[model samples]
Target chain A: MAEITLKSLAHSYSKNPAEPQDYAIREMNHVWHQGGAYALLGPSGCGKSTMLNIISGLLEPSNGEVLFDGKVVNSLPPEERNIAQVFQFPVIYDTMTVYDNLAFPLRNMKTPEARVHERVMEVADVLELTSQLKRKAKNLSADEKQKVSMGRGLVRDDVSAILFDEPLTVIDPQLKWKLRRKLKEIHHRFRITMVYVTHDQLEASTFADMIAVMYEGQVVQFGTPRELFETPNHTFVGYFIGSPGMNFLDVTVRDGKVFSGEAQLLVDNRVHDGIARATSDNVKLGIRPEFIEVHQEPVEDGMEVKVEHAQDLGTYSIVYASLGGISLKARVEEDQITPVDKAWLRFPSEKIGLYVDDYRVELPHE
Target chain B: MNKVYNNRAWWLILPMLLLVAFSAIIPLMTVVNYSVQDVFDAHTRFFTGTEWFVKMLNDPMLQGALLRQFAFSLTILAIEVPLGIGIALLMPKRGWQASVVLILVTMPLLIPWNVVGSIWQLFTRGDIGLMGWSLRELGYGYNITASPVDAWATIILMDVWHWTPLIALLCYSGLRSIPDAYYQAARIDRASKWSVFRYIQLPKLTNVLVIGVLLRFMHSFMIYAEPFVLTGGGPGSSTTFLSQSLTTMAIGQQDLGPSAAFSLIYFLIILLVTWVFYTAIMNMQKDDNKGA
Candidate 1:
């Protein structure tokens, strides 16, 4: 296993890129620690797959060096790099039997027959494809074909990492979860560096120990699921990570007071200093919907909000409301009494995050 | 439980039945009638009762033509299939070069069969053609009319030049349909170029190749126009294929009964061979499916 490092990696599909927007992957340096299960998570066209391809040597970075275990392998082809990649759709050899499909890589390297057989059988067992070992890959179901594709990667012992580019896209929902768990098990058992690329937050969080949430061709935040939920590094992450997402309100600081459409927010001294020190005119206040406390009557330092919609979501209802003409969502328990027209909303000081220019501004710890 | 038997759908097939009968069945019946009778004139005919069929089957001339037809078809297939696949493999996968190469390759296929024959005829003439003059300049006698080997080689080459593009075009479409992921996966697996072609490219090209082989076989088996024009089936019937022999008996001379018998046999042979080729390819697919 080897750590994958990108040093100022940037790629542009255009031949002569004049502006930063031309680059599919904007310049950045990042490290995927050896044996760590990490995900390059983002929306479509955000360049997660581009980064994965760069690490796998399927693509050479346009501007920077790609290092594997601290050695620059920028010019190396994928075959010479010893990295395995499972594609979005199932790509098993149609003519080969499942057994032979699993054994293909090892056979290409001329691995001994006995060792190939042992490894193939082990992977087949893990993937629950033992019964289909004799069957042609073309005849297997989509998920089984995907498993066979994954098994090809697992069978090779010398691979530095196994990269997945949305490998579950073609699989059924039930089989997707099972195969993901199987992949996680394989990662743990082998201790190989696995980089899963997906636009789905749930898939990334469940499959990767560290999810690198990407936005607009850059990694906005790299943290655990809980860390991303509690403390999103960028406004994009705050908007992307949770269901219904974090509610952001445009605010202006005047005489050490934060005003969002004339509704003054109660905050600690640190936030007040942060707002005052912020240089960008696009200053905003952010808070997760889960942290917003809603009450029928106004409390101390509470702001009134109009209740537009309250959806009953079985376990918890998402209450959509507007404070000072700005829309916000709050997740309330099923038994929580929601008012028809209005409610008092409180943004907890501890959870309140101040932002300037969509980037999180550091608030001094109280 | 009574079923509604709508007779209206049966009327819809009436037009199809009439077309098939007019185009196929009526002509076929007339040939069958001639095969069983010795016809001096349209109005004056005598029932022969398999006499023409027995005589024609025993004729050594027809047998030689049958054997030569097999050899020629097999030779052309042997040369064309592999050569076509090789040309397709060497072709550029994309860009303006690919488009230019596709247009150039498809040039020969656009020519009519008679025109293809006329083109090859002049191209292989010792006095006027570049190829024949070059061969003669190299101290070789390359006369299609005199040498059986030259006649065979020139006709085979002409057929290959004219038709290999069909195979190549089919294969090119087949190759293009294969996703780039297979190649990337092959690279990741460290597959050799030969392994990639054998396991990935060849397997994917099988469907198209089957079509190419069957079409080429059927087209080549009825080899009349090109050989008749280029060599005139000369060098003492060296390249006189089944169709030329049938034409000679049926149209050139007025031996209707024997020629009709020969025509039926020729049709049956083509049908049988095509069936065999199609069945073999299909059974191989079935094995891959493994009762899926």
Candidate 2:
């Protein structure tokens, strides 16, 4: 495995760069350390795959350089870049036997026949496909075929990184869990640098050591899952990183005080001071669904809210409604029942996050 | 079993089955009737029970035509199958540009068959055709109209232009149906261009190529309009094929009985060959699709 660095990279589909905003992937800089597990997470059409392709040398950036271990490799083809990638669907050769499909890449590299056989056998063993080695690929189940695809990439130990682009999306739900755990096991054992791309928050948060949340062709935040969940650098990150996502409410602040609609909020002056510098006074308050507890009566530091709807999800309930004209959601215990008309909600100061213009206003711990 | 009654599906197939019987079965019955009888005055016909068939078996002209038919079918398939696959491999995969290129390539196939024959006839003519004129200018004697060598060249060239596009179109559809994931995986595997084609593209193309071969073979076996209009089985009948020979006997020479027998033999040959090709292709695909 080798470290990968992207230096001031920017790309656009147009020829002349058109305007200052005519970029599919905007300029930014980041480094992926060797043996680190990272993910590029985003919604559909958010340029995550484009960024992944650029890193794999499938597309050249209009203005920037890609360096592998401090050596420039922007001009190298994907093969020369020593990166292995798995696509959304299984892509093994239909006519070849399972053994042959795993052996193809090694054979192309002119690896010794004996060693190639050994490598393929080892991979098949790891994948639990030893019994099906002599069988043709077309007859296998979709999950089995995809396993062969993964085997093809992992057969070569010299490859610097293995890139996965929603590879588990086509897998059956039960198989997705098993394959993901297998991949994690493979990464832990091999210590290979891996970059996975997906729109699923759970997959990214669970698999990657660091998750890069992208929105509108730019990375909004890059941090550990806990960090992203607790202190999202941008409002988009808050909305994207959790189940049922995070609840957001607009609050206007003036004279070191926060106001949600007409109801005033009690926030520390130090927290208000950092937000005061960001110009836009239309501040946003963010809280995870888990943090906003639902109660029968308005508790201390709690706001009275109307419960619009309640979703039953076996163990917990999600109360969807608005608070002070802004939509917010609160997670409640499944056994507790709140009237559909109105309920009291609590937002603890420790769990409340403040943002200005979709970006978090970093708070002082004190 | 009695859950649903979809009688509307019956209405959909009634028209189709009636059309097939009217257009195909009735005419076939007529041929069968003619094959076993000797008609004196349409009403005074006598049952002749395999008499014409026996005579056709001894006819040297029918044998020659049959030989020529297989040879021409094989030659056309050899040229068109691989050429179609090669062109398909080079076709652009996406965008409006692909649509534009596809239309241009399919334009030849869309032309009327007789017109295509006439166009190629002029294009291969000794004095006026561009190919002939260019060949002569290059110090080679070429005259497809009266010379056997020229006649064969013209027929081969005409068949290639008219049919290669059909194969290419089929192959293009087959190639396009392949998902992008395959190519991406190939890239990651670092497969060479040849390995990608052999292990991926060619294996994937076998099913369609079987269709290409069968279709080309059947069409070339009965190919009449172009060669008949261009060569008229001339150049000492070197270009005479089965359908042309049948036409010569039935229409030109007015030998109705022999022609009827000859047509039955020709139809049987095509059916037998097609069955064999179909069986082989199906077996191979089944194995390929299930072996793993």
Highest TM-score scorer: 1
* All models, RMSD in angstroms: 2.1, 2.8
Which one wins on DockQ?
A: 2
Q: What docking tier does model 2 reach?
A: medium
Tens-digit lDDT track of model 2 for A1-366:
789998998888889887757888898888999999898999998889888888888888888999999999999998899888888788889888899999999998999999999999998988889989988887888999989989998999988898888889878998888998898888898899999999998899779999999888789899999999988889899888888888777776676677777766655665566556557856788889888777787677666776788888889888886775667788888678754878777777778788888888767655
Tell me the tens digit of each residue's lDDT in model 1 across A200-304. 899999999999998878988999999899988889999988998999988877777877777777767788888878888888889999999988898986778
Give the clashing pairs for model 2: A135-B292, A136-B291, A136-B292
Which portions of model 2 miss their true places by more than 4 Å? A18-20, A254-256, A272-278, A335-340, B1-16, B91-104, B133-139, B288-292
Lowest summed lDDT across 10 adjacent residues in model 1 chain A is found at A259-268
All DockQ scores:
0.56, 0.59
lDDT of 2 by residue, B1-292 (tens): 6778788878888989899999998888778787788876757988888999999988887887788778888988888888989998888988998999899889888887788878887877668989877889898888766688878878988889888999999999988888777887788788888888988888888888888888898899999998888888878878899888888888988777777877888889899999998997777656443444
TM-score quality measure for candidate 1: 0.96
Q: For each candidate, what is the lDDT?
A: 0.90, 0.85
